[model samples]
Target: MYFPFRQLLASSLALTALTIPARAQISIGEPIPFTDTFSGTLLDDTFLVLTAWRTDTGSVNGGLFGRTFVGLTNEPVGEATVSAQSSTTAPNFFMARNSASLSVENAEAARYTTQSSHGTHTQVEFFTPTSLTPARTRFHWNVSGLTSSTYPGVVTNADLRFAAGYFPTTSYYDFFDLATQENGGPLMSVSGTGAFSYNLPLLLNQPIDLFYHTVAYVGFTAEGGETFSGFSDFSNTHILDRIELFDSNDVLISEWGMREISSGQVMFDQNGRTAAANGGNNIPEPGTLGLLALGGAALLGRVCRRTKKGN
Candidate 1:
């Protein structure tokens, strides 16, 4: 039977959709493992931190760290009180007030080899998803100053670890691992029906602010690399952001950087997405960041100049 051209097209289009892969609807739910932020308060063994997880095993640093307390550990025994340091109960807005770190001198023999080297995550905790069915969980984090991080030496196998506990014991989800020693780190991600994981790397030796606006849930993910960065340093600021793991301690390193134990959120898609977002997140341009890095040019002098339409 003959039918109208427009109707025939509509019928054909509807049939085509039947063959396409189906998409599932999802959304973010309340945090599962943590409700409030604190210096230490984690379920032992569930929250894991390594002084040098995979950066590079050495004679100086190595071993897994479990954070089941409320403050820094491995601190040297009693000694004369020097000056002092300052940390805040509330983190400065849009900045990483929470901090963590490890030292080679205080670390035990490498967890991997005889000469181990690495640092532990400050707030190590175990996490599992119970909100949505299953999909790649999105990660959103922020940093304030160079003091967010510190590294006086080098590391070899630093990586962003993405894992999963999975519902009904789903498949292994460790595909979101990558070597994070390159420029601006890695700005990428992955997703699928079963699970998802993504990471944003930090730029070395620079002060920068960052944010994540998208919702791509990573079922169960954790961020910590190298266990330790060898000669590394981390603190809330000059006074608080420190890891004194030595008997003869001296605050020789500090930078405006990021937290060793980053604050992350797991989000899901409300409208649902068939694929993942693959875009270059951020890599400061030489003209813009270069000037800021040196403090040679006024903040707006060069960037504000623009030609008005038609002279």
Candidate 2:
């Protein structure tokens, strides 16, 4: 069953307010990199698993409205389940299981619209133990599995976004579109099973507090006949095999492979303070602002649609 939008929002806000600083897990001064291979039974303490959703229900002419945001650490909320699961394909890996089903019937109006989405985000927030700036940095991750399916009358798509940076507010917690190069690192998408990396922008002469954020999302939408139904299932998908961090000289600084996750040495903070301390103007690499601008445009489109419906 789905939680009420207002209730979900209230619960998320309360959780955000109660979150405390994460313990120090990684020290930048060391040359050795930290890594986890997921060989353990449980997910390491270095990562925070979060589940969220955005559901819109309304007539086609009236436009879909209502959005609920839920951010829970290491728990399932709505149709999304964030956990560490094992399977034949992937013996040990981080998985985000999600499914959604909805139907709309408007016999008199002869119009109907249905939209549902579920997302799971794994975030690792950390701060530099000492003042140390690198010439460049690289964030790498491996995806082991991904799957998506949708029933007739419905169109579905699965998207993945990876980002890193200092996000100090609760507003940016579960929303992937809000991740821009300024407050967070540039958003990068992964299509299928494989490895990916991002060349992070340089931050000079400041105490650094950062978060590596990755989310797997599946959405289903349908609009047509007076009576229609849609169902989607995305399970055992978006599995992470390993995540590694490298410094300017290409030296591995930290890694989480799931094996030694506890000893992986990557800090996991829920509430970060770097942005507030640095005046909230941490700039991104040149030429990457356009990516976020496009995201903003998409968001604006949704707002415009709602405005037209008098919502």
For each candidate in turn, the TM-score is 0.21, 0.39
| Candidate 1, residue 48: how far the Cα is off, in Å | 8.3
The digit string of per-residue lDDT tens for model 2 on 96-124 reads: 33333333333222212122222222233
- Residue 193, model 2, lDDT: 52
> Against the unseen true structure, what C-alpha lDDT does each candidate score?
0.18, 0.28
Model 1: residues with Cα > 4 Å off, grouped in runs:
1-28, 31-93, 104-311
Q: What is the Å distance of residue 32 in model 2 from its true position?
A: 26
TM-score of 2: 0.39
lDDT of 1 at 307: 20
What are the per-residue Cα lDDT tens digits for candidate 1 across 172-222? 111112222243333232111112233322222322222111111001011
